[model samples]
Target: MNKHNAEYYISKLGLLPHPEGGYYKRTFQSEEQTSDQELSVEFEGKRRLYTSIYFLLGSDDVSHFHRLKSDELWYYHAGSPLTVHVIDEHGVYKEYKLGIDLENGEVPQVLVPKNSIFGSSVKDEDTFSLVGCMVSPGFEFQDFELFTQDELLAKYPQHQDIIMKLAYDLIPV
Candidate 1:
């Protein structure tokens, strides 16, 4: 096995299965917080100033379509380039390549705006991508929203291919 393969990082970083797919471990959570009065209706209560995690996605893995109440920034750390698919609030679909290959339009950092339905995948066969994600105003279970195929299809029919590939076939009841 290669020294830096998916399993190698998973074990080294103490990554565990993430609800959104792939593997991850929270790396930071700021002590500073936002009070309930400062947060919007989407937030349940107080939230930390920011939170970060180390995320790993294998070529065969799917991050799945999900949205958060706060913006998320993704930074490429190692391995293959990652493709981040986004369907904005206005229904505009865009893809950002996160990697070090600048000439090919791959960016080292990409941002997913709040409320956008988005997902990520690693395209290189048999390899994986390691990344760091930071969410401002922190991240709470209540702020996370995973999509179902039918629900996303109803709203963004034009993004059928991506939605079908990334959205869950069935949402757990």
Candidate 2:
């Protein structure tokens, strides 16, 4: 197989434009569901135990800051490395490089805990990245929240630069 660009993955994988940015296609939803009694009070009904998607980001694309009710695990698939910026529930900020490079501190998989604000971008300007994300307790539209610039800045005043960069709308030309 030959290396391809973001457009290739988007078309081949049948990815759609994602609200938080990037292109993605849900690839899995487990038949098993968490029992209502075992579920968090925030959940109104039973939910699939797990879900997964193929996510792609081009050099110019940015996965805006967003949060989910369930923890999300990211697995690197191909293309260039991606930088995932995260602000934990405690307000601590961190960056994780997602790729196959272990010598340079890149990790093939990373976990973003529930309710942690996060975003991502292709590490190299001319490249793209393809990754897989798995969310436990499944992924429901109701469980997702995209952060607004003002709202996020209010909560994380110290991360203004990055917040502004990732929070702005990316109107495609």
Give me candidate 1's TM-score against the actual structure.
Answer: 0.96
Report the C-alpha lDDT of model 2 over 36-151, residue by residue, as the tens digit. Answer: 68976477788899999999998898999988989999999999999999999999999999999999999999999998999998999878999999999899999888878888
> Clashing residue pairs, candidate 2?
none
lDDT, each prediction: 0.93, 0.90
Q: Considering every candidate listed, which one attains the maximal TM-score?
A: 1
Model 1 score (lDDT) = 0.93
TM accuracy, model 2? 0.93
Q: Write the per-residue lDDT of candidate 1 for residues 33-139, one digit (tens) a residue.
A: 98878976457779999999999999998999999989999999999999999999999999999999999999999999999999999978999999999999898
